[model samples]
Structure formats: C-alpha cells, structure tokens
Target: MKRAITGLLNRLRFKQKLFLSYLVVIIIPILVLGVYAYNQSKEMLRIQGIQGIVKNVDTISGSIDGSVERYNHAVQSIVLNKTFQKIVTNDYSDLVNLSYDLQEYLTPYFNMMVMLDQEIDDVKFYTQTYVPEYGDSVQSADRVKDEDWYQSALKGKGSQWFSDNGLIVVAAFPRFFSDKATNLVYMRINEASMFKNVAALAKDGTVAITNDRGDVIYSNQGATGERLEAGQLQGMKEGAIRIGGIESYLVKKTVKQTGWTIYFIVPAKELSRNAGSIINATLIVIAGCIVIVLIMIWMFSKTMIRRIYALNSVMKRVEIGDLSIRIRSESKDEIGELTNRFGSMLARLNDLIDELFRNKIVQKEAEFKALQWQMNPHFLYNTLSFINWKALRSDDADISRVVTTLSKFYRTGLNRGNNMIPVRDELEHVKSYIEIIQTMKDHSFDVEYDIDEAVFGHTTINFILQPLAENAIMHGIARKESGRGLLRISAKLSNGKVVFQVQDNGIGMPLETANTLLQNDSSGYGMKNVNERLRLKYSSDYSFTVESAVDRGTQMSIVIPAYLQS
Candidate 1:
C-alpha cells in the first residue's frame, strides 16, 4: 500500500501534491478541532460578558456616589457657617442697614460659593424671615412652600439630594439659631457634569439611576420621566431577564451615599457581538494558515529546482571559457556542496592561467633584452653626441638641442636594462620626450609639471609615463582647435600610494573611446601596454582611469602602491 501511495504522489504535479497533502494533514484535523473549540468558547464568552458588565456597573455606582457626597458636604458647609446662619435668621429694623449688610457681607459669601465649584449653578437661601430678596441669592420660603423637594428638606435634619428633571438639588436645614425658623440652604448642580461618566459607559446600552420608589431619576437614554415596572425591578435580582420585549443583561448596583440603584441594561445581541467577531476571526486565521502552507510548499519546490538550473547554467559558462563565474551558496546540502566544489575547480583553473600568462610575459621581456643587447650602447651615444657637435658647429641650435634631448631620453629609458626606475628618472625621461615634441611642433603647446618632491625617493615600472605623455600629445594636444593647448603632468604621494596624472586641454575623444583605451592589447606601445606592464609588475590593486570630454579636456590617472628602491 505504501508503494502504491508513493507512486500516485510522484505522478501528480507539484501544486497538486501540495494541495492534496494539505487537505489531509491540516484541513481535516483543523475543521474538527475548530468545531469543538467554538462550542467551548461560546459558553466562556457569555460568562465573561456578565462579569464585565457587573464590574462596569460597580464603577459607575462609585462615581455617582462620590458626586452626591461632594455636593452634600458643600451644602452642609453653608448650613453650619455661623455668619451665614445669622444673616439668614436676622430681622432688619432699618431698611438702609439691611440693604447695606446684604450687599457688603451676604452677597460676597454667596458669590464665592458659586465660584469655587464650576458645577454649582446657584446658591440660594429660602426663609420665612423678613429679609429682602437679593439677586436670586435669597428667596421667600412661600414660593417653594408647597414643593416636594422643599418639604423634604424641611422635614429632614441634614443634607438631602433630590433629582428634578436630571438636575441635582441638595437642601440642608440649619439648626444653629434659637428662632426655630423654617430656613433652607438650596444648591443646584449641573446635571451633565454629575452624569458624564455614566453617559461614557453606555455606548450601546441604557444606564439609569432609579430611586427606591422605582422612578428613573437620571437616565443616559433621556428616559428620566419613565418608571421601571415592578416586575422588571423584581426580576433584576435574578441575572438576565426580558425587559421591554427583549432578552437583556441587567447589572445593577446601589449608590451607598443615596440608596439609589444604577441599572445597566444591554440587549442579548449586543452582548454576543464580541463572540461573533471572535468566531469570524478564528475562521479567517484557519483560512490564512492553509494559504500560507500552500505558498511555502510552492516556494520550497521552486527553490530546489532553481538551484539545479543555476548549476547547469554555470557548467555551460565554464564550457564557453568563462572561468570567473561564482556561485555564492551557504546551504550544506548535496547541491550546495556540489556548487562549492565547482567554484574551487574554477579558482584552480584561474591560477593556472595566470601562471602561463606570467611565463609568456617573461619570454617576451627576454627577447626584448636580447634585441637591445645586439646594439652597442656606447656607439649609439657617441654617434648622437657627434651629430650634436656638428649641428653646434654649423650654428643650428634647434637641431643640436633635439639631438641632445633624444640622447637623454634614451639614456633614462634604458636604465641599464632594469625594468624598475626611480620616479625622478621617469619624470626626466618624459620631460625629454616633451622637449623633443615641443621642438618638433615649434612650441605650439605649453607644458607644466606639478611633481611632489616626496615621490623622488620611490620607484615604479619604466616607460609608464612616456607612453601616456605621447598619447596626450598625439591624440589630445595636437587636436586642439584653439591652436594653443596646455599639457599638465602631476605626481603626488597620498596615503602610502603614488598617483600620476597626464592632462591636456585639447579636442578630447568621446567617453566610449576613452573607456576602451586600456581594455585591449590592440594599441601596441600605447595605454594598453602601459596598463599591462603595471598589472604584471604590481598587484591588481593598481589601476588606470581616463576622463575626457569633447570641448573640455582629457585626463589620464595611474594609481599604484609606493615602493622605495632597495
């Protein structure tokens, strides 16, 4: 059976195999487990919903109780003030004294109480004593004698909180005077400030504060005029119940300061919304897991196949004489190890090629030396000196100078068959070549030298500068349309390296031509030859760079490590 199953899988395409395996390994087991988890999570969510509602109701109860206590204390403070009590109970004999005393003392005290608490709208004293009403701060008791809140204040001994149309009214009866007067201290508090927290907690629900008589005193739903049914109030003791034809969650807590119950009612659908969201999230996560698994399977197969194809490509390149190709793989698997071995083989082949190339260079140099030795150096110098003497005798200064400069140029360039020469000697050789060219051209161009004295002690490959200077004169300076070109040769030592530059202000070549100048060996005894000689003598770090523009100029730079002659 195992062999049959393996054969069936091998015959399927890669994507088909992935989908079939995923259906068996992940989809089947997850569907079964997801059903079981949903059943368990539904029950847990309902219980936690009730607990959360209860805690929220308790918090609202605490906040309402704190507001009530604060207002009660404020009322009590005014009632106990002896000066206030005297002002309320005193009977005026002279009308002028009464007006003066009310303006100077009582008016300022009432204004201060209203200023201290931003929630306090007004502070008034109601009394049957014969005192003039002063700007709504004092009023006659006859106006509210029949009111229920006033009656409750008259009957109560301490401060009592009363709600009238969502407004908070606190009244306190003072007993500090012996006149036995029906005097009440009344304070009105802003209702919105008192119930702001309840409004915040009742987003999708209704919150109400109901008195013992089941009358809604303050409701965030604007149902302050409604009264809770006796049956609904009784059913609240037993958890959630039907309220107004909807099955709802009821959480109620009694405000300890006033004996008022705060009721929080949320419909069943609203409470179960979170559980529905959690179920939808679980389904999405399962679907996402299946998608991610499919993607991972595709990527795994593609990666293996891609590496194999890359190895094949590398082998094809090696067949076409391209041994510089490299494969950078960190994997330790069989394919990765194969790639590593291939790279090692390419490296060995490159080393062998370099060895053969160096041997060829040595053979060519030996042939050049043999050709040089065939000529007698003393005889050549003597013949050049003899021609110089004849030109001088004939009174031809230009010919004599040219011959002398030619002799000096050859002497410096030969250097007794040594391949390396001092930087000073190389500079002198190029100077002689420049002098010969200037004499030949009738001094059409200017020459400038910016050689640093520090480079005089260092040595470099011979004939590196002469070929560059010759190219500058032949290709750059000689083609200037301005008829007077400037040739600047500069050498400097920087950061343990020596840099030499040959620049000319002439009709320059295009960037494409400058780029290919040193890339091939077709230009014999030119820029290519100079670059090859430098590469063979020094490390590969040595480089040549060329810059040119049509109207601007051409500048060629050579950079090599500074080496002192031993």
Candidate 2:
C-alpha cells in the first residue's frame, strides 16, 4: 500500500498534489466542523426541549398551589365569622336555607375553580361532608372522613395553615369552617387534577399520574393510559426510563401528599428537526469552498508548471549548442530572475566564442608572416652572388670592392638563414650594406653610430636594421640636394627598453605617408611585413615609429624591450 501510494503521488501532476493538499488542509477540516456542528445542534435541541418541559411542569404546579391557598383563606374567613356559629348552634330551623344561601354566595368561587381546571386541564373541589349539593363528587370512604386530616379541619390544629407536596401525582389541602361550636368542614385533593394539568402542558408527547400501588390514576390524550402499566408506573416513581427508537425525553416527580408519580414524555425528533437543515447547509458551503480551493490550486500549479517547462526548454537548447537561445520572462519573481540571468550568461558565452575565433585568425596570419620573413634574405643572397661573380671576371677594382662589400652584406644579413642573432651582428650587417653602397654609388653620405657595447650581444631579428638603412640610403639620399646626406644610427638602453633610432638628412615624407609607414595603416608590402614581424616577435610593446617633415629629414625609432644577451 505504501509503495502504491508513493507511485500514485509520483505519477500525479503538481495541480493534483495542490488539490489534494487543499482536501487535507481545508476541505477535510470543513467536513469535521460540519459533523461537530451537527452533534452540537442535536445536543442543544435536546436540552431546549427538556428545559421547556421542566418550566411548564413547574408553572402548572405553582398555579394549582395558589388556587388551593385562596380556597383555604375563604374557608378561614367563614370559620371565624360569629354569624356562622349562631346558624350552627341556635338556627336549626333556617339551617337548610342558610346552607342554600352559602352555596349561592360561593358560586363565583366554584366558577373560578372550573375556569382554572379547564384552562390547565385539571379538576378541583372543596368539601365538608361529601356534599353532593356543593359539587364535590369524588370517591370517598366513611373511614376517610375520620382520618387525621378530617379531625384537624374540625378544629384548626397546630396553627398549621397549609402543606406543600414533595412528590408528584397527588396533592390535598384540608380547610375548616367552624361556628365557635362543634361544627367543622374538611377538604381533600388528589393526583387526578394534577395529571390532567400536566397533560394540558404536553404537546407532541404524553403525561400521566400513577398511584402508590402503581395503578394509572389519570392520563391525557390516552397516551399515558395505554403505555403506563403497574410496573412502568413504579419505574416512573423511581426514575424516568428512556425508551429506545422513540426519540423522546422523560421526567418523573413523586407527590409527597399522596405518593403518586407524575411522568412527562417528550419526543426528541420534533425538537431536533432543524439539525438536518443545518447539516445540509454546512455541506453545501463546504462543497463550494472545496471547488473554489481546487480552482485556485489548478491555476497556481499551471503557472508554476509552465515556468519550469520554459526553464527546462532553455537548458535543453543550450545543451544542444544553441548558446544564443534566451528565456524571455517578464515576471519579477525568482524563476523569472533566474531565467534572465541565464540568458545574460549565454550572451556572454557567445561573445567570448566570437572573440576566440578572431584571435585564432590573427595568430595564423602572424605565423605566415614569420615564415615569409624567414625566406626573403635567402633570395637576396643569390642575387648579390651573381653580381660579385660578374665583377671578378671583369677585373674591375672599384666593382671588386663593391662586390666584396655586397657579398659581406648579404652574408651577414642572411646569417645562414637564422632569424635571431646578436644586436652587434645586425649592426655590422648594416655597416657592410653601407660600405657596399659607398663603393657602388657615392661617399657623399656621412654615417655615424652611437651604440652601447654592453648591449652588442643582445638578440634581435638579423636583417631588421639593414632594411631601414637601405631605404634611407636609396630613396632618402637619392632625393637629397648635392647627393649628400647625414646618416645616424644609434642604440642604447633607455628605461628598460632597447632604444634604436636611424635618421637620414634627405628628402623627408609628408605626415600622412610617414604615419602610414610607421603605424602600418597601409600595407606597402616591405614596411608592413617588417612591422608585422616585429609584432610577432615581441607583441605590441616592441614596434616602429617614424617622424618626418618634407625637406627637414626623416627619423625612425624602433623600440624593443631590454632583455639579457642569451
């Protein structure tokens, strides 16, 4: 079961989980509360029904007691009257007439008793001699007349005016009317009237009275008469019995005066009918709430799921080499922020890739240039060799001197095809090229060198100085006045850099052309190639600079970072 539940949960969507959470957290609680409310309502209704019955029984008993007291007062007034004594002791002739007048005077009292009994569904009587004329027609015995109550009524006993019943089902009050002689009156009451009164108060149920022998004395609406057997009556006297399946409440009270029991039966069904309505209403509300919660859960889950899918898609594309793909999310939440940052990272990655490609191309071009510079000097050596061989066969002395200078120039410049050599070797190559030029052309040019001997063995590209020297002597000197020019070559240590300068007093170039040659903005093959080689050897720190003004002279500086002779 546990594994099955785990699998079910794993297969369910986020929305399903959200809905289930609502069921556990909200809907279930609502159902529990509904059940709680139902039980509370049932209990409250039962309590209300019981309280109503108790109140009705208490009110009826009070009214009956009040009526009995009023009758006692009337009888006391008649007993203290002196006129009533003379009628009993001396007026034997008018005795029947006096009794008739007394009955007539007490007509309103009898009518009052009838009205009270009718409204409460009970009966009442005030009797002295079981008088049929006085309307007291209850069962009585000759022995009952001589009972303690009868004697007490004949002459008021113990200053006792009245007594209250401690139990239900029976009640009685004895009243005496004496004439200061042997004349007296007595009254008694029982459970019959009390039972009838209890019945009047009952609705939707029953009420009854039972004697000490457990016999049913009275009942209302035939309900109590049919259900109350002798044994049931005894049980009522002891305590109320709640019958099963009858949705009812029962209360019992025993009358102290007559040992009779009063039983009240009330149906719980009638009082608790509203409980069903409350439960139905509660269920309707809970169901509505569950629906609302489910809708909210679905919407939230969809929103969350969609964002996660979008992020996953972005990652998949990135994994497949689509580095340019980006997530476009406008929400200012955590997921949105994460996507935005990821997009930015991808953008940076694409930029870095492009930069790396460009760098690779630049490196390949530089390698090609280094290879070209390696081959150029070998070609020049072959040309100079042919020139020297021709001059030797002709036996020309000046040409021989020129050929020898030229031979030494090419040999030193090539340095046996080695690209790097000592700084002094390169300078000597420059001097040999100058000697060749002086022999073949003219000695009108003045040459000077200002170099530090300590830096003579430092390594440099073998033919770099010679090219500048040749350019100055040929193009620079050929345009000079009188065919004479000042040539200055200098190399020294300056601020951890090898500072080398070659200046010629000859026709100078325009600013634009001078900048183009030095900065190498235009690729005039020889100058651009030389500049590129320098860059390949020493990066941006080592390069050429040219300063020139027309007819003023041209000066060039090649700066190389200083390093040891090795």
Candidate 3:
C-alpha cells in the first residue's frame, strides 16, 4: 500500500506535489489545531464567565452587609441613649413639660440620626407612658404592642429586622426602660437605598434577597411578594441550576447580619453568549491564516513548476538533436542550479560533437592528400633514377647528388602508402629535404642533428618534422641579417614521451606573432596543421609550443606519447 501511494505521488507534477505537501504538512495540522483551540476557548470563556458573575455577587453581598450594619448601629444608638430612656420612662404631670421634653431632646436626637444616614427615612418611638402622640416619631406603644415584629423586638435581646410595605424596619427595645412598659424604637430604612446593589445586578440578570422564612424580601425580578418553598434553593451555592425551567448559573451569598441570602441568577445561554463570539473570531482568524498559507503555497509551486517546465521544454528540444538552445535563470534555489548544470552539460556535449566531426574531417583530408601524392611516386622515382644515371655518365656530380637525394626523399616520404614510419626513416627523409634546401640556398645555414638513440624505438606521425625544418630554413634561417643561421633538430624521450625540437638562431619574430603561428590557419600546414594532427592522434596528451624573441632566435617543440613500433 505504501509503495502504491508513493508511486501515485511520484507521477504527479511538481505543482501538484507541492500542494499536496502543503495540505498534509501545513493546512491539515492548522485546521486540527484551530478546532482544538476553538473548543478550549469556549470552555475557558464559560468558566471565566461563571467566575466573573460569582465575584460580582460576592461584592454585592458585602455592600448590602455594610448598609445593614450602618442601619443597625443607628438603632443601637437610640436604644442605648440615657436621655431617651429617661424621657420614655418619666411620669409627667403636665402635658406642657412632656411636650417640651419630646420636642427639645427626643425630636432633635431623632432628626440628627435621620440626617446622618440618608437611608433612614424615619425614626419613631413607641411607648406606653403618658407621652402624647408626637406625630409618627412618638407613637403609642399600644399601637403596635400586639404586632408580631414589635412583640418579637420586646422579647428579643438585641434588635430585630422586619420587612414591611417596601420598607426595612429595625425594631429595638430601649435599655433600662420601665418593666411595666414595652418601649421600642423603630427605624425606617429606605428599601431602594438598602437594596441598591442588588438592583444594579438586576440589569444583567435576576437577583433576589430571601429572608430566613423563605420569603423574598427584595427581588429585582419583581418577585418580592412571592414566597419560596422549603429547600427550593438548597445546594445552589455556586453552580448551574434550573430556575423556572430555564438552565441558569446560581451564585448565592448570605448576609450574616440580616440572615438573608443574595442570589445572582444568570442564564447559561447568556454566559456562553460571549463564548460564541470568541469562537467565531478565532475561526475567522484561522480561516484567514489558512487562506494566506494556501496563496503562498500556490505562488511557490507556480514558481517552481514554471522553472521545471522551462527545463523540460529545453530537454525535449535536445532530444531531437538540437543542442543550440540556451536557458538562463537568476534564482539561487536548487531548481535554478539544476537548470544551470543542464545547460553546462549541453554545452559540453556540443563541444564533443564538434571536435569529433573536426577530427574526422582532418583525417579524411590527410588521407586524400596522401592518396594524391601516392599516384606518381614510383614514376617520379624511376625518372629521378634515370636523371642520376645520365648525370653520372656526363660527370655532373651536383646534378647526380641532387637527383639521388630527391629520389631518396620521395621514397621515404611515400613509405609504401603507409602513414606510420620508423624514426630512422623519418630522419632520413628530413636529411634528404635539408640536402635539397642546401642545394637551393647554396648551403647558407648550418645544421645540427641531436637525435637520441632511445627515441629510435618509438614511432610518430609521418611528414611532421619536414614542415618544421622547412619553416625554420625559410622563415628563420633565410631571415638572418649577417651571421650564418644555425639550425638545430633534435629528438629525445622525456617522461615517457617523445619530444622533437627545431631551433634556429635567426631574426626571430615578436611574441604575439610566435604565439599565433599555431592558431592562424593562414600560416599553412606549418605549426597549426602539425598541432591539429598531433591532437587528432593523441588528443590532449601532446604539447606543441613556440618560443621566440625579436632578433634573437625561434624554437618549436612537439611532444607526443611514445608509441613503440609493433
């Protein structure tokens, strides 16, 4: 299966392969992580929402506790006042004195207490003494003696809290009052000021303050008049719960001072509402990233595939034997490098083809020229022998010698239509040519032969040394100024190779002229032809060099591998 998959992938183009790689290496992993992150974010937001609401409920509970504490302090102050106690317990004989004491001390004290706390709407004293009914401030104890809250306050040691008609009342019995009378001071607390914190929370969700009797004393949900059943809110301190058939989160705190519980109820959907937005935003970001990555992948694949396609086109052209195409790229990537290397290979291939054809043409030309010369070698040799016999019979020694030497030169040069010859035969051929040149130039130049015996065993290309000797005598020896030109011809074995040198102390040419002698074809079968012939025979192993200085001398050397005669 794995091999089948690999084969399938390998058949795809570069762009397709790149896209597939991106899908597996980049896109798929991103999508997986995005999904995981979205789920984690949703859970985190839900948990954080619950935590936030719990903190708000705790803050509101503390604020309500503080308000209730202040109100309690106010009630305690009134109960512990000695003057208020004396006034409530005094037996008055005149209504004028009773009214004077009530207006002078008790009214000012009550007004001061109310002024200090804005939540206190009113302060009233209920007594069974002969105190006149001083409006609501000094109410008769008989007015509320039978009232459950009043009775409770009289029997209770401390103050008792009561909720009545949208008001929070604190009823407390005065200290040291007459036992015959049930005197109490009750303070009216503004419900709005007392439950302001709970009201603030109501704007967001349902909030309620329930008393110990399971009666909701203050409900922002308009359920203040409703009563809860026993254990209705049990085990609902801080977690999700079902309220009125709707799933909601419940956070509850008890105010120790009032024995009332504050309940902050928020629907589960509402808490998760923000989580939805966060998840949506996260998904959008992930989608945007994926889109950008896809674009980049596409661009990268396009770039790479375009270069490959170009290379493919060039290769197709080459397949049809067209090797002249040129491709160029400026990129530093591996694809560009491959393209450059391919171009180099094509160039090298073209060079080898050209060199092979050139070598073949040179070999064919050499054979044709040899065949042209072979056609009349026997006839020319017979004619030259007849001329030598005639000169010998007439006593013309120079003519006989020239004719004899000419016959010898042609005899050795032809060598029975074979291109290979011994070193001794080639040297004899060159000696005959030199004899003819001396006869023509009147022996103007001196000649020397420094041949090594070791080189006699090796063979070289025929007719190569004759041209060098001719060039030396014509271009070097013939151009000498005053002194007789000295021509030196030497052959030796050096470093497993055969070396032939032709040198002359004649008027030498410039360095540039000497260098171009082997390159310029117009120089004619002298150095350039010999160099090409040596290369055809030995490739790059042979070396030919010309060294000369103006008016000094010229030296030409030919080096080839030492091939022994078989």
The most accurate candidate by lDDT is 1
- Give the clashing residue pairs of candidate 3, or none: none
Off by over 4 Å in 2: 1-394, 520-525
Q: How do the predictions measure up, each by TM-score?
A: 0.60, 0.35, 0.43
Off by over 4 Å in 3: 1-31, 91-93, 175-178, 222-238, 272-284, 287-566
How well does candidate 3 match the true structure in TM-score terms?
Answer: 0.43
lDDT of 2 by residue, 1-566 (tens): 99999999999967678778776888677778878877766766666656776766565555545544554554455445554433333344555765764455444554565465442222223233333333442223343466544454445442122222311112233223642223343333444453345556665567665655566655555333245455654544322345534545677765543445667676656554433566567678877887888888878877777787778888998899988675668989998888888888888898999899678657746655565455566566677677777878888777767766776766776565567777888888889888877766668778998989867757787667877887787778767976568889999878878878889988989999987885554333356666766876788889698888998888888888776777
What is the alpha-carbon lDDT for the whole of candidate 1?
0.80
Whole-model lDDT values for every prediction: 0.80, 0.63, 0.80
Query: After superposition, which runs of candidate 1 have C-alpha atoms over 4 Å from their true positions?
Result: 1-27, 87-351, 360-376, 389-396, 494-496, 521-523, 538-540, 564-566
Give residue 228's error in model 3 in angstroms.
8.0
Ranking by TM-score: 1, 3, 2
Query: What lDDT is reached at residue 245 by model 3?
Result: 74
Q: Give the per-residue lDDT digits (tens) of candidate 3, residues 1-566.
A: 99999999889977888888777777677788788877788788898778778777888888988887777777778778776776676656777777788889888887887787788888888887766678878878888767777766777767677766755555555544336776778887888887876777655677877776666677765222233333566556578787777777888888898788888888777776544677777778888877987998978977668778888989999999899988767888998899999988888899999999888977756764765384687789889989999999999999999999998888888887676788878888999999999998888888999999999888887788988888888888898889888999899999999999999998888999998998887544567777777777788999999999988889999888999988
TM-score of 2: 0.35
Q: Which pairs of residues collide in candidate 2?
A: 167-254, 167-255, 167-256, 168-254, 168-255, 247-268
